[model samples]
Target chain A: SQTIHQWPATLVQPVGSPLSLECTVEGTSNPNLYWYRQAAGRGLQLLFYSVGIGQISSEVPQNLSASRPQDRQFILSSKKLLLSDSGFYLCAWSAIGDAAFFGQGTRLTVV
Target chain B: AQKVTQAQTEISVVEKEDVTLDCVYETRDTTYYLFWYKQPPSGELVFLIRRNSFDEQNEISGRYSWNFQKSTSSFNFTITASQVVDSAVYFCALSCSRVHTPLSPMDSSYKLIFGSGTRLLVRP
Candidate 1:
């Protein structure tokens, strides 16, 4: 059984502040990790995906960036947060030819 | 380029009634995959079903079933005797299969292209 942990489930920050959200998966090694953001009443948008340590693919250009410092650890960060960057962020992993498993998600609100 | 389209934005139905959510996708690849996921008020996306392009068989799992038609490029999900617990936003996604190229045993799975979701509301 694999489990994913995401921290600071909910956060509120003043505009122009920095942001960091961490996600870690246990029980699986070398799993495909992804970062997604969902705006209120909108669809999930793929932000970044990592194939391995130090290898990341960005799906869209935004104020966000992702890094895989370890095989099971993925971090989403931003040097300066924008009001538009606020949304519900999700981290997920999957094996080849398998369905993806998502974490609880982090709700970020930048005002 | 792959794209997923969920035609219905919102649907409301009474409890115990049957409901069907429609999904249409576009991809040029011969080998691709389609999936349906549920996101409840908890805000967690739950995997429902996955259909590979090679298999067109319709399947029934308990109160849930899926219909796949390659000709129409549609994959639809139906819930029989729907319950309030079934109320949630449903998403349709598409992914191209990793063909021939032997992937390392540790390669991360390919990414899924997602569609705008449909919110399903089951009322009592």
Candidate 2:
């Protein structure tokens, strides 16, 4: 079985502060990883995806960026957090022709 | 451009009743894929079903069934004898198949374009 873990399940920061959210997958290799954001009562919006280490694709360019430093590790970072950045962030991993396994998600609140 | 539309923004149903969620899509390419996912109250997504363009035959798994209409470009999902646990936000997704191609930057490997999602509430 595979499992995904995300740290700092919840965070609150003032506007213009820095942001970092970490995600890691275990029990799978060379899996497709994705980052998504969901606003309150809204559908998910794709932020970024990675096929391999150091290879990242930005679905919607904004104040956010993603990095895959290791095969199983993915990180979402921002130099300055904006009020619009507040949302529920999710990380997912999937194999070929298979379902994606999602993380518990990180709830970011920018004050 | 490819897009998915889940017209029903919210649905409320009583326990043990049947409910159907509607999804319509638009795409330029003829060959593509469709998917359904469930997001529970905990905010974790769970994959429910995947239907390729060639597969028009409907599928019934346990209490869930999917209707794929190629002519209309619609994929709908239904829950029979629904329970409280079935309450969740359902999303319809579209993907472009990358067949027999090496995984590369240009090769689009099942990239999902999701809909706005429909929220379902089952009351006991």
Task: Return the top candidate by lDDT.
Answer: 1
lDDT (tens digit, per residue) of candidate 1 on B33-76: 88999999999999999988999999999999999999999999
Q: Estimate each model's TM-score.
A: 0.93, 0.91
User: Which docking band does candidate 2 fall into?
Assistant: medium
* lDDT, candidate 1, A4-109, per-residue tens: 9988799999889999999999999988888999999899999988777887888899889999999999999999999999999999987655688899999999
Clashing residue pairs in candidate 1 (N, C-alpha, C atoms within 3 angstroms): none
Q: lDDT of each structure? A: 0.89, 0.89
Q: For candidate 2 chain A, which ten residues in a row score worst on lDDT? A: A93-102
User: Tens-digit lDDT track for model 2 on B27-121?
Assistant: 87777788899999998888899888988999999999999999999999999999999999999988775553444663554566789999999
* Native contacts retained by candidate 1: 0.64
Name model 2 segments beyond 4 Å from true: B29-31, B99-109
Model 1 stretches with alpha carbons more than 4 Å out: B99-109
Q: What is the TM-score of chain A in candidate 1?
A: 0.98
In the predicted model 2, the residue pairs found to clash are: none
Give the distance in Å from residue A62's predicted Cα in candidate 2 to where it truly belongs. Answer: 0.9
